[model samples]
Target: MLVSLEIERVEPLADGAPFGAVGAYERVVGKAKGEVDPAAPGNRGIALIDKAPRNASGKVEYTTDIFILRPKDFSRGNGRILYEVNNRGRKMLFGYIADGPQGVNDPKTMADVGNGFPLRQGYTIVWSGWDPDAPRANMGLGLTAPVATDSGRPIVQKVRDEFVSGTRGGALETFKLSCEAASLEQPRARLTMRERAGDEPRELPLNQWSFVDARSIKLRDGSKPRPGWIYEFHYEATNPKVLGLGFAATRDVVSWLRYDAAALAVTGGPISHALAIGFSQAGRYLRNHISEGFNRDEQGRKVFDGIHSHIAGVGRIFFNTPFGQPARTGTQHEDHFFPENAFPFSTAMQSDPLTGKSGSLFRGDGSDPKLIETNTSTEYWQKGASLLHTDPLGTTDVTLPDHSRVYMIAGTQHGGRAGATTDAGPNVNPRNPHNPMPAVRALLMALDAWVVSGQAPPASRVPTLADGTLVEADRTGFPAVPGAAVVKVTNQVAPPGDWVNPTPPAKAYRTLVCKVDADGNEAAGIRLPDIAVPLATYTGWNEYKPPYPAGELADRDGSCLPFAVDAAARQAAGDPRPAIAERYKSGADYQARVEAVVASLLADRLLLPEDAERYRERAAKEPRVAP
Candidate 1:
């Protein structure tokens, strides 16, 4: 294996504070190894993967980018390394409060480093580019790979491309992901119109569209497609990038930082322990990394001591493919099906009753590290978070390993906002004000303590079918709130397949959703102090309007409807639920309720003392309840 690291550039970050600011560096890691096959099962990704023929050196060559954020003085830093897996070239896990658009380790300026939380924590942070398509400016990184081919001829393959119109327009302009043009100008095109997930799909004829350029497609009659309609084009695209190498590249980099003493010297001493944190797309990547056994390096040593997977749900990314689009996280209405949601859905090793394939994410080889997996209420309705705990057949619950804990942040959307009230998000749905980051921060501290002091983290708390909290989606007892889009909360799964010609063994497996109480709050999962002491009805599902179906859960958004200020308002609406005033004698009483919830969580080891006071302050400042 030709695994090597080179420092490209180094600069000071964050004005060189007490830890003397942060020392940021640009790096390139290249590996020379035997040729790899993209079709092999576990071999889907291995080491620093290469798709092209080995050079005269008799080794395949591949290079990928990485950005390291360390203390100027290594002694001033926490000996731990936090490898943040980037989602489409953006660094997550820091959970920063940025001044504007910010990339976590993006060089040039860590100026407005959003509260600089990570900096204060003293952990060395690292970001690397595994996606080849990522741009270069603003600290964007990428991997370099050769096009896969057979002999001297180009290897032709079928590819699937899904197009969703972001804006309403007369003509929709489409572009290819990895390839330049279609091998045959007109391949096979299919268009479908659907207002929502369960709505009947109306297919448009192939003759209605044609290719404008190698990548661009246009309507044949000079007309435009509907804004919410989904368009799929399976064309003969050439020069498919060896996208599978991305997973391998990421594995090698993390491995190098963990074990390579020389590489570790640059950041002070060797990493005594390492933790990986990813949200959404990046979260899925972390799941695949362990599920595929990428955690065991070439030397057969574990890479991370723990991983924090936030909002990933049960789906691993469709990251390995001929022309992989690492950024695409398919929703129900758009990009219907691809390889994003595949088998081995749960962390435990189990037999797929349908496919007869048996595998587990852990090796039991003493390399399976501890894990803290957190999700929001949105995941149950959208990304199939329930499936992670449930069996493939959704018959029984799957027992989690002792080292792993799964918590669902009740009544919040994916990556919720801070200090938000009943407000509309940038998406089509109104935003749920519930923020999971505070709970996330506390859990992370628990994870760190567990790793360092051999202390056990908090118990896993999530909705379960055994308990009435986890129930069928349609059975959630939601209260009547005007304009609340409380639709059937079920998983929308499709058959996993090849980009173009997919031969999935099954269409969709059993789906489960969490049960909500009369106030529309999820009954299962970790209830934050705010959730336990409620003001508004925080929910995990929202809806889209017109062109899109109304009651369908809006993509990754949630809803928040403030309760009636008094019993008169509740009676006026004919709503049976008691109003906020009826529950709490005064605003001070509400603050005490919030305090009790926080104290309970703190005693249970789920909330830190520092965070307890923070939550208390948060409740005290709630604008909705203020006089």
Candidate 2:
């Protein structure tokens, strides 16, 4: 039977003594010559050294002059000596003695230098071997003391005790025996910082950092005198708004080596130095401070054009969003995804006549009016183009002609929900309900394989409709909306009577109106509208028209009197119901709202009818799951 074997010194022999040394000669004699004497009782299987006694050295030592003798007996029924005893024992003994000094004595000297047999100080030699047939046999013969201090303890402990430590026996030994033994050389690390010609002021907090090295490496043949291993270090400022974050890279060292004549020790290598510079800035700066565009001469022109030009062919572009942008349909909101902006406002407001107004009154009409209808031909769309143009930033013109991979993680909050971002507060989403990290990792692995093996990645890892399960890479683009369910209303609007001023003096007025499907189902694709009521007195009103004049009875002076329901007002309406008594009942209101919006979109041809119908059916049968 084949078996495995392992051996270790559970309890090291004391007094620096070697293991199995005492019985070495006795075993050798037993194996070479079966028995020393046949007439002696109980000595049939015994060897000569078994009867030897310890000398003054307190240990058994085989004498160099010891020899083996074979008996001569008569043959062929005649008592005659077969042959005179030959002097072969002395001749064999001579060869053993001649080889002993070099083999045995030299090994003993090396052992003493390495700290008596496999251990010295606190360092112990550890090794492993296997013999298929003799599983239980000794397999611990290959262990040796560390190359550096064959007689000393680990350097780390020595350093802790206020003594200088050497790397010769630790990392160097392990590196040489493992990595270097295969003829692999450690690649020199290189760092390239993106900066302009002049010095730029920046600061990088060491605490918030990530070090990314080659996950797997392949060396190129005939590349250079010293080929470098590619690595990337990504560091984001804890304060997300702080731009111009800088970074510095250097080799990680344990302790410094000192040169001293008394010790006569050779230092391992020179300490690695660093290149420090800033890659980003809090605000935009020109390529040259004194360049043509220095004096605010190009305020209306694109701010990112120069930066994009400078970084054209340097390296791959990385898109980083410290705080995720609010979910929107198109790229109009992309520029606001960066940290420079504190809050999101519609681009239409940029050209508002009263643009300088404070508080929430900065946008739209001054009346805090909802559903204010305005023509799209105004400057609103133009402002959107300007703001949106800044989004691609330095990467606007960059084309990955090499077919470099692009990984877009769906349903992920910016900068990770828990990392170094201003949004990392307790109230933030604890976990991304839609897990996308797994998918991102799979994509990265695929890219790695593609780059290394010349294998093209699959057109899509996403599952077909017939496939039964979702894989990591399958969840690539966007998260599927959760099943439609009840929506919970945390905030409620007051009824007309409860309002500071009631219109038409009605007993029960509909303060909030929620439009549902003709079937009155609260599933997906149900529509909602603003609160509609009979006017106390109508000056003039039209469903498709706006800016209708209020009649004489309109309470224009009071806070709640001049209120009129409009399209914008319907879209911005808040929930007007109390919390459910049970926790499960809370999501009812939101479910109703989402269904209503989806229904409207379908009606307006914004969504495909088939898609709308499917979602509606799903929402009706089961609750919508949140992405």
Best-matching candidate per TM-score: 1
Global lDDT scores for all candidate models = 0.69, 0.18
Q: Over the stretch 1-627, how does candidate 1's per-residue lDDT look in tens digits?
A: 225666665666645444324333223222222233434443445432344556665545567766777776676677788888887777654443222233444533444455455666778777777776767566666777667666656766666676656422233555444455544445354545555434565766767776666657676776766665666556566766667666666766777777777676556667788888888888998888887777776667787889989899887876666666666776666655666887777767788876677766666777677888899988888888877888877778889888888899998888675645565642344678787776787788888888888899988898887887777778887777764566675656654755565443455677777777777777778899767888878877777666644444567778877788788898887766678888787768889989888888888777767668878887788766644
Number of backbone collisions per candidate, in order? 3, 25
State the lDDT of candidate 2 residue by residue for 201-238, as single tens digits.
13223322212222222223322211111112121111
Tell me how far the alpha carbon of residue 406 in candidate 2 is from the true structure, in angstroms, after superposition. 2.1
Candidate 2: where are CA atoms >4 Å away?
1-399, 417-434, 458-627
True lDDT of residue 400, candidate 2: 22
TM-score of each: 0.89, 0.17
